[model samples]
Target chain A: MKPTPTPDFDKNHPDRAAANLATHAHALFAIASEHIDSDTLRRLRAARSDALSAPRRRNLLPVLVPAGALAAAVLALAVVWHPLHAPSTAPATAGTGAMLVSADSSEVDMAQNLDFYDWLATQPQPASAASAQ
Target chain B: MNLAAVPQHSEGLVAARAPELPVTLETFLAQVQRRAFRVAEMGLGNVDDALDAVQDAMLRLHQHYRQHPAQEWSPLFWGILRRRITDLQRRRKVRSIVVGWLGSVGDDGEGGPVWEPADPLADPAREIAGRAAYADLARAVRALPRRQREAFMLRVLEGLDVADTARAMGCSDGSVKTHLSRAMEALRHKLEDWK
Candidate 1:
């Protein structure tokens, strides 16, 4: 298909002088574009060949470097934050006072005291202690 | 049909249909390189910088949009070139300022393209007159605001339509018209004495 015609200053319009000037200037530009020096032409040819032969993917190192660094920084922050803010899983044990105990140790202690608690339950409490309780 | 005959017939068909196919990247680049250079030269007013800009634009188009449809190449290529020219212009301005502050002489000379007559026996008087006229036109164009110059060159010299010129300029079609109108008015006044 033919391309759309470029809009030009109308010859029959009031600005005939401008139309004429555009026409003249276009012709001159055509000439100038064609009459490039041999050296410049050679350079242009080399440039074209280089462009065509070169890889399609641009060197994204500049962009990728910063992007990669940002991603790494975010990952580091996440790693640090998870440990600092994650909920504690250790079992809460009453009567342990201010001492912190691991879940396994707390469970073991409860098992060892089971027999003693059972024996104590079988014995009756003193009257004064019962009244205080 | 014999196998040889089949192959030959298909080859003939392919050859016949070649012209109807979309333009390849190399062909597109070859077609626009010169005119692109000229436009760059006009914008930057330096030969080496213009050539660099054209080369950079060609590389960018090849790298980024080589796989696009052929019909999209013109606008894409011109748009890339226009941006490259603007970039070079900005760099030159910054360099000039820095050089001035350092008390160093900057190379702001216009190393324009060398023009030669196509016909060796062409009339010297006519050739000289044409050259003078072209020089004047180039000067006037360079003096225009960046947008106006871009609009004038793309729309007038390169013969790109309003839509393509708008795409190339990264602006609205209405803005292209306004800039072109102002450019023409300015050029007419500037070249009033030219016959």
Candidate 2:
């Protein structure tokens, strides 16, 4: 319910110019408020009280915020770790994987290039290494 | 400041230490709530909606900004309540638009508005007339456009200074003055007999 602006309230605002309609408007609003029935005011007050107490019923900012942050952090960790901390692949690359599985570190001759191996295969069996060492 | 940078405000909003609000807060709310409801009703034209707006504003002030200095509460609460009233007005406008579109249109358009003067019996050349003059005044206030009505209520009725009203309205000081002036003119023309 609206209240009629009381004479005291109007008088209290001495700073306001007397010529303005604020005083009259205040007075009118005060009258309007006075006309409101009691039951309506009670309902409004009840609503206000309920709102004041709503945080206890469900304050999302407390629990939901931390929970949401934790969930997001877990999601981000999954994304980062999936790429960086994954288990070492069996062989990593196609060529490396095939050769590494079939061969060993000792079998992989360091100086033996694949191009040299092809050229040697094309030659006449290296001429028995020139008939002697 | 970007609000996302700090989540601590949530603590202030949710866990409002009742002690933080000064003793004036309760008295201030109790005193202002009725007038706020009336002002809201003038803007909304619906008692139920006006009640909700006032209650919401009270809760908002109590929960979020009650910790602010008591002196600043009037303008702050009025500003917040004004915004709430405008929000409801916008929602009602949207609903009305939808309904108007669905419903059939008429050429006379409800046969125009009725702007009758205040009931003569309610007035007798006093500093203030009885209930009828006030009723006429309220009717005229309601007849003004949304901005004009808000300006009248906030700047004049609420006694908020131009700057405070502007802050509440989220407008420039110049705009507030303009609205107030226009509202005064409109109200004076309609409510000339009251004066």
What does the lDDT read for residue B44 in candidate 2? Answer: 72
Poorest lDDT segment (10 consecutive residues) of candidate 1 chain B: B1-10
Best by TM-score: 1
Superposition TM-score, candidate 1 onto the true structure = 0.65
Colliding residue pairs in candidate 2: A2-A33, A3-A30, A3-A33, A4-A30, A4-A31, A5-A30
Could you tell me how far off, in angstroms, the CA of residue A53 lies in candidate 1 after the best superposition?
A: 1.1
State TM-scores per candidate: 0.65, 0.59
Tens digit of per-residue lDDT, candidate 2, span A1-133: 3322322223344423323244555645555555556776798678767756655333468988899999999999999888686657633555665676678666566323657877778987467778886
For the second chain, the TM-scores of the candidates in order are 0.76, 0.71
Output the number of the DockQ-best candidate.
Answer: 1
Off by over 4 Å in 1: A1-7, A58-88, A91-133, B1-22, B104-129
- Looking at model 1, residue A73 earns an lDDT score of 100
